[model samples]
Target: MRRAIAAAMSRSKREIPHYYLEHSIDISKAQDWLQAHNAERTPEQRLLLGALLVRAAALTLKQTPELNGYYTDGRFDPSSSVHIGMAINIRGGGLVVPALLDADQASLEQLMERLKDLTGRARHGGLRSSEMSAATVTLTSLGDRGVDSVLGVIFPPQVAILGFGTPVLRPWITDTGSVEARPVLRVTLAADHRVSDGHLGARFLRELTRKLQSPESL
Candidate 1:
């Protein structure tokens, strides 16, 4: 059904219109924390950890303010809330995104509890139309799928989409200019050209990298 829809949409210029934006996030530091902390949780908790990372990004966006809202009315409205759409399985196949809004303001406990419900509804096809509609931004994971990184298309009207890939052990530079094995995940940020500039995009990645190092946010 999704393939059919995508094909049909592609036949026209404006149907499901999109633009591609690509950027990479080196998550070597964040994975080190996840590997250790993952041992403390059940499988469910580990899954929720992915959602937490997305929520953390929304928090990072909240700080920037400019990157936090949907572009509408030929103008950008700085969202007072941070709503991040989480992509999960669609009915039978493909995927759907159910949002976890205002994550920046939500307490840790609230995020966990709400995410459980959102992810559940998303997989089972019970997600409300409204939940899938009002996404200010997106955070999608392809961990189990084995993608390294994806330069995805911006879901129309939304300014950006974030894609995450599996973490694998690889060699990276140290302060000593030596090599060390680090677990790294690739992140691709796709943005609408009308909304984001090269400098703001660079700033977003810099801030996100700093958040990964904060430890507590993880």
Candidate 2:
């Protein structure tokens, strides 16, 4: 596992020119909706905010094709389907990232269930071969670990990786000129510069923020 990780990281740094973009998104609406949504469901069926983030990112990728695909053999191959690689840490050490297939097409409930199942399988060793190799893009989060923010390394072949930081309560100015404490999440995008520029990355983050602000659609 260590050897595999080292090889992938070395190749990523050696071959992919990476550019990063960060956005502090106000997820107050999303959180509120999640809380309300969870209130109506049983404990075993409740959804986490991570599910929403993945869903939003998957949908946003449809608009930004440059960030979601493989770069191999000196070319970029875009994918019509969105398979988000979810980073899951093992019990003792290391990690595995398994792709959640067709994430853009899955409902929030289904995505949550699949994410939970994937995490369990990844940690305990039941992940399939397809899930291991089918990711178009990867998503990692340190929110549970109390990290304020993270800038991730671009996984080779895949053009981009997204990092989500812990949601913090901050004073935000509203459209009506009122100061309110809102749950703000810092989202970072690390993309292969060979395939995309900063402008496209910025647009992708903005689109994600817009989707997160209105979580009902996810």
Candidate 3:
């Protein structure tokens, strides 16, 4: 632990102590909306995206509260905050995730603002130690590296990790019955065998996709 922290230098090494959960999401419309969302992105998108993911994870995790918190000394500790650890790729090939502050309860807008601020700080090497240690769940977005879908290892103590894939252009049949290009993302989910079954994992993926397809893109 000390070595890892030293490697971080001023940076904080998140010490998570529980098993993990992993989720991969495929969004067919992600590419299209990301382009538009980028054009009009306000730090607001940060909260909106975080809220969407929190809500998505909550929907599934709430189904089994036993998996919602830390599992230490061979036991689970339930958590009230749906704090989400968001993974970010900054310079130097170091992947860091600053927990979205109180994400489970934050309003959409609030989540976005905090996400933007935390991410900015992380990039500049300004993240505080507390910020790194607070996450209850980790969400990873690989920028453009996620092409389709990726199954990620669950970060420890969180019980889950969500990965995002790069959007790809695929052929889709339009309403006019003509083949057209469509943006689609592949999704994957990994769950702790002790806490999640294939059925639960599938259900989570279904809900995530529904959110992405909702009026507000997840």
Each model's C-alpha lDDT? 0.69, 0.93, 0.60
Clashing pairs in 1: none
- RMSD of model 2, in Å? 0.9
Listed per model in order, the count of residue pairs whose N, CA or C atoms clash below 3 Å is: 0, 0, 15
- Model 2 stretches with alpha carbons more than 4 Å out: none
Per-prediction TM-score, please?
A: 0.82, 0.98, 0.70
Which structure is stronger by TM-score: 1 or 3? 1
What ranking emerges by TM-score with the best candidate at the front?
A: 2, 1, 3
What is residue 40's positional error in candidate 3, in angstroms? 7.9
lDDT tens digits, residue span 1-218, model 2: 87899899999999999988899999999999999999978999999999999999999997888988999999999999999998889988887999999999999989999999999999899999999999999999999998888999988899999999999999999999999999899999999988999999999998999999999988
Inter-residue clash pairs, candidate 2? none
Order of candidate numbers by lDDT, starting with the best: 2, 1, 3
What are the per-residue Cα lDDT tens digits for candidate 1 across 1-218? 68854863354235323444454445665656667767888876663446457656877888766666766667777678777888786657877777787778776557777888898877766778778776777787888788777665555556677777777777878779999877676776766556667678777877777776664664
- lDDT by residue for model 3 (1-218), tens: 44653554332123332232344343445434545655766653423343455555554555555445664565667677666777787876667878775665665566656767887898898998878888776676654564556556566565666666665677867768998877665555555555556676666767667776662633
